[model samples]
Target: IVYSWLFWYHSQLLTMKTEASVLVEVLDINDNSPVFENHPATVPVPEDHTVGDEVTSVNATDADSGFNGEVRYTLLGSAGRFSVDQETGVITLAAPLDRETQDEYRLVITAQDQGRPSHSATTTLDISVTDINDNAPIFSKQQYEATVSEHAEVRTNIIDIMATDKDDGENAIVTYHIVKQEPSSTPLAFTIDEESAH
Candidate 1:
């Protein structure tokens, strides 16, 4: 460092400034929420509805920035039953629906943004599967049968059973299986139905 003396009038002196710089801070706002136009939207459809049939619609909003505000839709549960369009927020029925077999569906959906810290939101969707009598009856006791004694008391307890099928076709035919009490077993039984066992 060098100290030079200029025109020192009355022994008074002062200095001038030299360099400077600027800084900035960024903040985040509520940009997006994985939500639908309505919490639970409804779409009436026939059991034989086409694949392209529009099931329902949902929408998401983001206040961040371009593309950052862009949202994508995703169906989290029972996907084979329905689907969502990422851009249009439109949902379409993927397969046939039978309220008898599966009355209603509760779905989880997410909306996410393409950002550095990526933000997302989750929401539940209630889908009511309308009835169409499309589901055929299924036999729980496929190939099982029981022998009842001639003197057996009426309404005697038998066994428990159930059945299910993906299609509403005759493949859903109802039948039952009953393994009667053997020599090592106790009494015999009788009675059957598609609904229950006794």
Candidate 2:
């Protein structure tokens, strides 16, 4: 919106008189929209990251003055998994994250001005959930039955047992250990390979 004003001035002298008009224009303060900087951002968060942790911050600027230039933030998507501060634009984790269930999330952040007809801008936030050692190894069967000959050699293979972990990277690496043995033999009658669980 613009307002225009006209001013008229008259000058009189002996035998001469002159008149002039001048025009001036004024612009409204709520004419500009909010703009985000460095939009379409991507952030990486560990799966074990605690809830209410600050992930990142978003910023915007408005050319208008007073309330029209004030910016507020809003977060969309992720089903309430995350939150953003309205005045600061700081994104925070609102719930626990599991990489096995969902590895990534797409969020839409909006910045709006406090004008009469508010103007808003949106940006995409790609949150990548990193791997962590949270899941334990789960065996395929609850119990195993194996029969071995009494005359078996010392290093003979007994049985192969396997377990898998849902985590990624080193967290998913499964190893085997012999915790107890039946009959309580003095020399340890059974053993398992650490790598192959045999």
Candidate 3:
């Protein structure tokens, strides 16, 4: 801005006069929008991970100064399973997760400034739920019954029992064991195949 004015000074014995113009500049405006930089597109979390654990972080920046440059973080579709720090942009787990029930989650993270007409930006986040050995193996049948003659051979096919687990990888692998029998026998009445459960 420029201003024009006239100034004069007079002394009792002498007279002097001066005139001058002045210019001023102003900076800073709420014109910049928040921008997300180098944030991950996808993240993986374990199903057995404890609640309130750190999942990941997001960052954003603005070119404006003061309150317009200050960014706040938020999660748009966390579904009560995740949360984000307003000032730090750190994401944390908010609830227990089960991969069997929900394998993945799609969310949007938002960054906004404090300007009068807040400027904001959004980023997509894909959170994949990794498998864990949290589910126990369940037997298809409660019990198995088989009858054999006293003169049966040493190796004989018996009733097959099966159990299933909802977990993945080695966690889903099921094996069989003969813990006990109804009546005690001198050399054990029957045997089972651990692999086939025969």
Candidate 4:
């Protein structure tokens, strides 16, 4: 009976000798903030662009996995004039653009992850609104009066005329021409400068 008991204890020890191993990998947490792909960002928009026109696109990336890597875009201080897509990061015009009203716009764009206690990054976008011809030239004075002697030289300098245009660049360029002259039957005796408009 002692030998039998010893055999049973040996069998129990052999069964207990069988062992297995396991592996556990700790996944990365949402620790990294979103990073902008572009720097010193700038976007050009025409002043005649409509409300739905697409201006530009912004991109960002996150190192984390799953929701932590997902990015959403937002535009700050646009005053409802611009919008960014949350998923695609495409920026579009939300309102009409007029360079005459506001020549340039500075916008702050942010990219945020969807993780809990979300991390975010920001970038500045400089939107330059190009000029468009929307205003006509207006003379400074409605009428001018000048007296000259009949013996005055043929190229005598008359009163200086001035006109202004609110537009910019070539749009604001003004050229002077005598559209209508008094004493229509009389020969033309006065000329105006094209460059100085005098």
Against the true structure, what is each candidate's TM-score?
0.49, 0.78, 0.78, 0.82
Candidates' lDDT values, in order?
A: 0.64, 0.87, 0.86, 0.84
What are the per-residue Cα lDDT tens digits for candidate 3 across 127-194?
Answer: 99999888899988886677878877778765678889999888898888778876978677777777
Model 2 segments more than 4 A misplaced: 1-25, 151-154
Compare the candidates by lDDT and give the number of the best one.
Answer: 2
lDDT of 1 at 190: 42
Worst 10 residues of 3 by lDDT: 1-10
Q: Per-residue lDDT for 7 in model 2?
A: 54
Checking candidate 1 for backbone clashes, the offending pairs are: 31-62, 31-63, 137-172, 139-175, 140-162, 141-177, 144-177, 144-178, 158-198
lDDT for model 4 comes to 0.84
Which of the numbered candidates is closest to the native, going by highest TM-score?
Answer: 4
* RMSD of each candidate relative to the true structure: 14.5, 4.2, 5.1, 8.8
Candidate no. 2 TM-score? 0.78
For candidate 4, which ten residues in a row score worst on lDDT?
A: 1-10
Query: Which portions of model 1 show Cα errors greater than 4 Å?
Result: 1-37, 41-45, 133-198
Task: Quote the lDDT for 8 in model 4.
Answer: 21
lDDT of 2 by residue, 1-198 (tens): 344555555556555555655555454568888898884467899988889989888899998888999999999997778999999999999999989999999999899999999898888889999998888999988998878899998888877788999999898999898888877897787778888898
1-198 per-residue lDDT for model 4 (tens digits): 012111222355455543344455566678999999965567778888988878888899999888989999999978789999999888899999888889888989999999998999999899999988889999888988889889998878877889999899999999988877766645677888987966
